[model samples]
Target: MKPNDLSTSSFIGWTCKLLAILIIVSLVVDCSSKKDVYYCPMHPHYTSDRPGNCPICNMDLVKKEDTSEHKDHSNASNSLQAAESISNEDHSSHLSETSSEKNSRELILSFEKQQSIGIKTELVSKRNLVKKISAYSSVAYDPELYSALSEYKEAVRSSEFLSPEIIRNLQLRLRQLGLSLDQIRIWTSGARDPSELILGGKSGRAHIYSQIYESDFTTVKVGLPIKFKTDVYPEKEFIGKIKSIDVILDKNNRTLRLRSEVSDPSQLLKPQMFGDTVIQVSLPNVLSVPTSAILDTGKQKIAYVQTAPDKFQAVSVQTGKNIEPWVEVLSGVQENQRVVTESTFLIDSEAKIRFGSDSHAH
Candidate 1:
């Protein structure tokens, strides 16, 4: 094509391209003008074109307040007094909604606070809370059985390896030595065999060296069936019949010795197993509460009494054996009174806010 004709074509093409670009730019601006940006009420710094939670405070994004939405009530009433009454009515409705929103906000805050603190509670009842006692006791082996096994160990070593006639001769010699034949047989076949003794000779018994309070022992009956468990074998339970309750106090350990017979012959029960033992006592018509509801601080125990919706009053309690998820309440609390089963801590916190320093005192 000729140079003049080509230059004219190029100018026309460039003009068309610029016109398209202007149209696109105009559309983008027009769309942006119609769109709205939102922000968070709690954290004002958070702003976004799309609605969502505030990145800084996790509060919901709200629409920016627009003053233009207010109605022009200038002509609603002709007289000044009438206009004033209308204005007051509108103001009251606005205030009512504001108060309701505040109440809802407080409820949400309380729920979240209770959840984060892991508060839980139980109900209080006054039916004869069982007069019970729970105390730790050490395990021990029978002293007589333990001593008999020690003597057998020495005699077995010679007999287990000896020939039949040699064994006979040894037995006759033992009899001549003035030891009874029963003793000889016991050495040969009984715990005298080192392998027969399950627990070590000296360390055979799990020693219970701890002591119980003198008054606590009075309620315990001799020959009462005892059921217990230990940490070593958590799934296994051991039951024993009380053989004797020692009247003499152990001065060194300051604990009373309560001898018991193993209910079952299974060797599953071992010494040094530390777990709770339940000594069934006769507590006539005693009331009990779910152990999960009680907050125990060792020196004293406390439970929250539900007075109203989400409202509770702290009550001091005397607790007995804990069966886990349930506890024996010796005194304090009444029947059918709902306690904060899941979020008692929230009530405790509110109580703290109401009475600073003394919140958890009870």
Candidate 2:
């Protein structure tokens, strides 16, 4: 219509368009604030309603992914990263599902991973654990046997001056001094008279002398089994029994010299023949674990006990009487419980890195 009317219409239309744009902008801002939540990718523990820097990591916060998918990835990432940290300060405390389970160093290993890493397990059972004492021994003569030989000579000579009764009594003394009945018969048959009588100086059997430490002295007992090995015959094993133990201990090493009687029918073992002796003293039935199951971190010895089918808890255990393949458990483990036998070092490394906390913390 008129020029002023046209200007008024144009101003009204421009105002309406500007108001619509502002309203649309306000709606988009409100929707983004309510629907989209941002979180720190580096520090997954830090989350925000909108984009900002992470308080812990100081990194820019990013848009959080789908809740279910993110939770799954976070759990897996935490388990793997639990063993990969080097700092003394833990960056994963916020990821723990429960504070009580923290510092337990639990690991959830899949069946496939357990098989691939050679992780094995065994039951803690009550069994006889032997304390093996290994030491160098020499084939020596028993001092009493030598005195017996001297007594035999004296008795044979004394018989010339005495009656037949005294000679028979002296011959019987030889039998009490470890001489066999056959040996005494041979002595009497060889000599025509008492002066011609000759007694064997050396005993046919071998006397093995081994030094036992003070720690193992109490466990060592008479009739305990011992096996001997010589350089001359490496494959041949000479089994013996502990015959005697010295009352006095060694001044330098604080050890006891024990004797074992070994039968040498072939006379392959001679006096002063050096040999290595292994004295096996069996202990009473106690809870024991496999040697491969335990991991020692200098101060603390650790073992992973399977708490669940796929979960394991790193437990500290007291060890005693460690043999080649088995070790006695003093405490920290119960009877019939399962313990990890292999891949312990790997589990230990993971535990320390995580500060013995939940491996799958999220």
List residue ranges in candidate 2 displaced over 4 A: 1-99, 112-116, 128-132, 141-203, 232-238, 265-268, 356-362
lDDT for model 2 comes to 0.74
Best by lDDT: 2
Give the per-residue lDDT digits (tens) of candidate 1, residues 280-341.
66654546777666766565677777565555566788876553445667777777777566
Question: How much is the lDDT of residue 240 in candidate 2?
Answer: 80
Q: How well does candidate 1 match the true structure in TM-score terms?
A: 0.37
Q: Once superposed on the true structure, which residue ranges of model 1 sit more than 4 Å away at CA?
A: 1-121, 125-219, 227-240, 262-284, 296-300, 320-323, 359-362
